[model samples]
Target chain A: MIEDKKTKILIVEDEMIINKMYAEELRSQGFLVLTATNGGEGLELALREKPDLILLDILMPIMDGLTMMSKLREKDLYGKNVPIILLTNLSASEEKIMSAITKNEPAYYLIKSDWDLSQIVEKIKERLSRKV
Target chain B: MRSQIQKKNFEEDLTNARIAAQNVLEDLDIEKTKVEKERAKEVAILLSIGDGLVVTDENGNIMLINKVAEKLLGRKKEEVMGKVFSDAILGIEDKEGKVISLEKRPMNLALTAGTATVNSIYYYVRKNKTRFPVAITVTPIVFEGKVIGAVEVFRDITHEREIDEEKSEFISLASHQLKTPPTAVKLLTERLLSGKMGTLTEKQKEYLNDIRFSNQRMIDLTNALLNVSRIELGAFTIQVQKKNACAIVQSVLDELEPITKGEQPKLKTIFPEQNIMLMLDEPLFRMIITNLVTNAIHYTASEGEIVVECKTINKGETVGGKLLKENYFVVVISDTGYGIPQVQQNKVFTKFFRADNAREKHVNGTGLGLYIAKSIMDHSGGLIWFMSRENKGSVFYAAIPMTGMRTKVGT
Candidate 1:
């Protein structure tokens, strides 16, 4: 069926409902999806799977997304080059968020409440297309 | 016989002179006692002042300091008296924790400029190496048209600051928590409406759409409340950069185009041939423009028109009795909509103030957009005002100084 050939995406979110909903939507869109409830688990899965793209949430238990992203970026060439999009409820004007975005090159962020699920899917697709 | 008469006259003259000298000495003693009483009273008044008070001489030397000042500075009166004002009370820092330069110290400014300076965003370090936020006022002491020294009064605002920080923290946390449910609902509703799970009837779809709309409104209210809290706390950071004014306005218009589509109001724009480069916080500038335009659209009828014009003016005009002077990059948003009633015009920028007409026309407004916008403008060294008649439309004007927005490093 060549199901294994589909592009893989990893979602690291602490909220179970949101993670499940996103996973369902992306799976229906014909992408292989992996989910992690926290940053530590997300980082381990990301390193092992080497997914095409990572969707990260900033505020999480057992290590935050930025910490994990930085650690992953430090791991190897594959980690440094992978596309990571930060999805959070934090305002972009926040000092911490702004600084983190500037430091993490080639990273994009979307305020979850401000963006619709469809728009987020569209953004994911746009990022994947650009990577290709 | 003549010698005896001369002796008697000489003795009488001597007695009168002696009496006059004794009376003069008594008067001098009484005057000295009164002066001492007045001086003691002045000293008592200075020592009893609630706020920390320090008086300096023309050369910025500390002349007198009250008991409160001594306790706050963690130094004895004998130790700091006659020392340089700024040096005696060392380690003054700005809100960013940067040490204040000598030239920028309020006492120095008051002494040099001969003006009163009041500031609340400063921290003072005590002798024990402990620091606390302070609200300080320094006034130049002038006598007979000559600039003397300065009088500084300060209070430790640690308690007030703690309360404010707690309030802001609570609001931020509450707003985030409040938004999460709405976000989940919005996403789930969108997923259900996509019809990937099952085929839905028209009525079901319509009901889901209503749910989504209401959920979106809840999210908007949360955001607005958060912004208001930030404004009240003076915690919003402003990073100023030079950007094209026209381009910023165009971008806002583009973002609002989706809402404008299929709406009754016809949106139009007028831009100068040459784009004006203004120093502004781009996001904040965009927010101001968006708020005004959105309000215009919401208030105006479908058959009405909305116009957004951008231009540069060498001199500013007074609108609604507020004078906006100097060179400015101005944006004027005018709409043919239900205007605000004249009786309620003054309260347009107040929090939670919706005019009777506005509440009647638009039901979902949180009445915070203009208040937040006005606070931002005031912080940015910009101006926002409008004129409206009950029956006619309203015109809102926002002016940004050519010099640029005031950059603030805030939480």
Candidate 2:
């Protein structure tokens, strides 16, 4: 395994336990993981850090994921090119909401309960590998 | 001379009395004509109204059956006149297809109670056995403080039921969306406890297992709710693609293998030698198969034997006189389990209906599985039915058209 020091990822989640668990798992997989508890904090750090990828949650305390996505679209590093995978607990039963979110074509929409940590890590690696 | 004078007075008085009697008789004739005209107007109004109208005497004998009532009940006026109200209208069934009792009939209630009865709904079956939903009102015709007859008016409400179904579907969808967080928690704990991330202590594993189990329950609840909404909304769009039916069932069985691992029931499968190919939606097909198989497993005892057989039948082949047209692909799941009681058999697919035995044995089921499965099959243009006997066993049959031909049947 090659240690790619420059490969950085940003995780924006409101739930403390889930955010910490995801961050720890990503770090173990040899990627630099930066985290924010809400979308507002996530947006500032994402602009400043210019990470290679973003894991965004839909619902948050200060600002939600969709709004943060629109704001990030304005920036240079966090532009449309950087893949943003939605990591959320929101059910995809609502077809309207799902279609709206998928319009921007996020890298993936992974329901939290449907996958394990290992599966998410594998997905991340596959996406990053494709980018490289 | 005195006798002659008395006779003359008597003759004059008699002539005056005759003229007064003629005037009284003319007034009586005018009043009679007025009464007849009012009665004719009432009859005309009943005949011209849109709603089906039926008038029954105090004894519940059919008095006047309007054209609409005759058409709705699929009976002729001549055949129904003078017949008992219940006997003449033999086509009325309840929502469950049970014949409504005579005492419960609206006209009988109005006549017996001597008061107006209004605003009730029931299914009205026609002579040809076709059924439609209807709303009815029965009013007693009271005259001079005596109950004379009762008039019943009913209107078809098929469209109203459809609207109501739509409203419930929206509510179900919203509830389904709310279960996402619990589902996420369950998945996370399951992964950690499975040791995929790292090794865990025995105590830690036990706690995580508890968490996973609770979360899984939440997941199942949400899934059932979502499926119900999808079925009611008629949201199942057939995205037909060629799929191997046997392979799809095998995958579903594999997923369920873990649940049956510890006290597993003896399982058997008989699939066709060639993969049964059909144009269908893979996910929905998987759901129908999974629901039936899961029910069989859950209801069966530890030592019970479960058998699943899949095969194809040629067009026009009939099972018990029910014709199966086109090429039919069928799956039968049978289990030696605590079967459904005979009395509750008709209500198996009804929402929130758990068999008495099933409820006593397994407390985890939400009772929405069969409902969602039936709905899915209906929308997919397939058929699902079952036969069961208490303490014996159950056999569930699911059939779908293998060709482009399909039947859109729903309960």
Number of the top TM-score candidate: 1
Chain A TM per candidate, in order of listing: 0.94, 0.88
Q: Write the per-residue lDDT of candidate 1 for residues B131-237, one digit (tens) a residue.
A: 88999999999999888999999999999999988898789879988987888898899899999979999999999999999999999999999998887788889
Against the correct fold, how does model 2 do in TM-score?
0.66
Checking candidate 2 for backbone clashes, the offending pairs are: none
* Number of the top lDDT candidate: 1
Tens digit of per-residue lDDT, candidate 2, span B363-399? 8998998898788776677878888888889999888
Model 2 regions lying over 4 Å from their true place: A4-6, A37-48, A60-63, A66-78, A97-102, B1-184, B187-204, B233-238, B404-411
Native contacts present in candidate 1, fraction: 0.75
- Top-DockQ structure, candidate number: 1
Instruction: Tell how far residue B166 is off in model 2, in angstroms.
Output: 9.2
All models: lDDT? 0.89, 0.79
Q: Estimate each model's TM-score.
A: 0.87, 0.66
Model 1 residue B393 distance off true place after TM-score fit, in angstroms? 5.2
